[model samples]
Target: MILSKRSLLATATAFALVLPAGWAIAKEQLDVVATTGMIGDAAREVGGDLVKVRALMGPGVDPHAYRQTRSDIVGMAKADLVLWHGLYLEAQMEDFLNELSESGNVVAVAESLPRNLLIGHEDYEGKFDPHVWMNPNLWSRVVLNVRDALIEVQPESEATFRANADAHLEELRELARYTTEVLSSVPAESRVLISAHDAFNYFGNAYGFEVMGIQGISTESEAGLQRIAEMVDTIVRRDIRAVFVESSVSDRNIRALIEGAAAEGHEVTIGGTLFSDAMGAAGTYEGTYLGMIDHNATVISRALGGDAPERGMSELLN
Candidate 1:
């Protein structure tokens, strides 16, 4: 019996399917690129095995100062869908993203957030804060927006994406609750959070802390001596316990704050390293979006005279 081309193709396909799952691979796959690791995490949750997600900024990378390398440009050009956190968080990449928007299905996930909830940029004045994801409650909204975006791109997988997004959103809600409960432990008097940069305004606003910063919203801005003196005096007079250093930003400013306080006969120490501007490494618990916030909540609560456990939210049983 002679086999025709169609009959041979059908037999080969049947054999391929019966072999193994990993052996049957497609030559082309969905291309997805997100600006930050946090956005990548959300996209991965929603996309699952159906899509590929790429983050422009990785662990310990400062988004504010990040410039698109030649490889990043190529990646963006090749992406089927690109998502970025708008609101000026990626100042350096703003122009690149704008240009990429004209060429492909590029989305600014944070743009869907309500204007009222966002804090305006200090120097830019009218611009809203780009760090909306700092608040877990606000972050949940972004996750939902991400689900919708992914559904729009791949309608066939809508059910899968929605379920994943729903599961992730539940985790985010739990994160918000945990954040509030943990922060509640900090005494009212010691509920001040002074960090190296002004990235945690939304966090403070959400959790009832008076947030102060040595530097402005943009890490590119300098912390003048006057600013340092003012914070030092505030710490000394107010008897503030500690300040925090971010993983992306240099600890130079925080070290200055500590030394200034020491010169004035007051002791100040860095409470702990905070995951700001980026998440921790992949595979580590601290690397996940939920873990990132959990770490921040635990650090801030303990540093500010609150009763917090070393292992983070009791959910982890630590």
Candidate 2:
């Protein structure tokens, strides 16, 4: 019981070697290390019992500024498959991820989307917005990326992968319809969504809303004095009632926007927190990709005076 560390390790190693065949058999699950929870969820949904998934960036962790921890690097090194959003979503870790491809199956799932479907980044040259998950229809395309990535790691599970992906896509189809039906109920002119950053362009395009953000696309890009001043002017001039904040981003910039609008006699209030770069708390209904979209659609519909169930598409489901 008081064995030295080295002796304990040696004893455990011997025990492992002497274990019964079934007990000694390794679990046949691909070790998947995904950078984002959205990707991680897809891996779990598609891979099912065939993959053990881990997400590097959890709820409220901004991927735009996230640098890999030593544990993340070690996990990725040991993983059978690796997935990231790409499209410059992980701006800070691009080089590191690129280098990983040389040694393993590191793939950028969203980057595989056709350029035509992507919104070009307004400020950055030759870059596209990475928040494709905002639109359930477009997100279906990314699901295929997850499917293919899983298949690549475990070719024998192709049937399972395809079946799970098809099911997920069908759910997305329902989600898209629900989003359209709910968001369309809002008065057309009252459809402007002001938020912490320019992360909702895809959501706006998919749902027909004019989106404005205090900062540019990447949260890494800071909002300057003039930018805040300009936004305050826009809010007052337009008489926008509700601005939203992002779950992964700081509310400091949004608070400034609120203060500035108040100073100008505009009563803009924080609408609701939306999931942007990250999903919601794990194990909650909002944690899943489906739940995340449903929550946003329901919240946006309610806050903007649209007709939607308060609990979402189905009161029983969420």
Candidate 3:
């Protein structure tokens, strides 16, 4: 049954009170519920064996439009810590998450990023772009925030969390290096990235590529015929070769761009699908946060006449 917010908060309070009694004499693993797979991955990496993380949104799920299910509400209520990418990334869940924070250990990891570093959200006043994961270097800051959250929830395990976070941060540094190197291989004029939406703004900003999107930052923003026609004109005039589709977003508009370009006697191909707003399948390497960015960098670089390995930075992308 769909529980009202009041009932859900009451249920959470009940769970919080009784949960301690069920713990063994030994400490139990900290239970973490993150809003997206990216946040969950950070928790798992930082918390290591000390925490059990569950991501509410999985592969191909659009956080922009996702609403919590009854099961999700129950899980978050029981969780010891809840992490969500703030900055309106979880647009639909913002109010619920804010309300949930009143009683639980809830943290908006991405919101921890400094304002000066963030791109302002065009549609929403005072809100920053939520897609910080696009730039691994910037994401490193979020990883630190995750580490701090885990430590706050369970201070005794700070050593483990610190070590794990350090290792993960190193990996992220390497990912940033690799992406910068490969993405740099594209000629300046060919470095334009056109996608289903404006999810890659950070990536563009980080790597010096111009980005175009048929839809706005949120996929919920509609792409009109005029926008599509404008993009088509841009592509043809610029002699752009490839445009990308996102895993979580519909490709209808991208296809429209291609058709429009073709009608103008200019061919535009679909660059490999990018994992925007989500990662790959659960079991694959691409499902991991590192692999997700690696795949995007490799795909974008290769499609835009740059050099990147077929398998990606770690040779683990699938």
Best by TM-score: 3
Question: lDDT of each structure?
Answer: 0.84, 0.86, 0.89
Residue 137 miss distance in model 1 (angstroms)? 0.7
| Candidate 1: tens digits of C-alpha lDDT, residues 1-318 | 333445434544555434434322233556788989999999988888887777889899999889876556656665678899989889988876776676578899998788888898996878887778789988888998888888888888889999988888888888888889889999999898888899999998898889998889989899999999999999999998799999888999899999999999999889999998999998998888988999999998988888877888755654
Ordered from best to worst TM-score, the candidate numbers read 3, 2, 1
Worst 10 residues of 1 by lDDT: 17-26
lDDT of 3: 0.89
- By TM-score, how accurate is candidate 2? 0.90
**C-alpha displacement of 41 in model 3, angstroms?**
0.6
Which ranges in model 2 have alpha carbons more than 4 Å from their true place?
Answer: 1-26, 316-318
Residues 110-134, candidate 3, lDDT per residue (tens digit)?
8868889999888788888899999
Shift in Å, residue 95, candidate 3: 0.9
Worst 10-residue lDDT window, candidate 3: 18-27
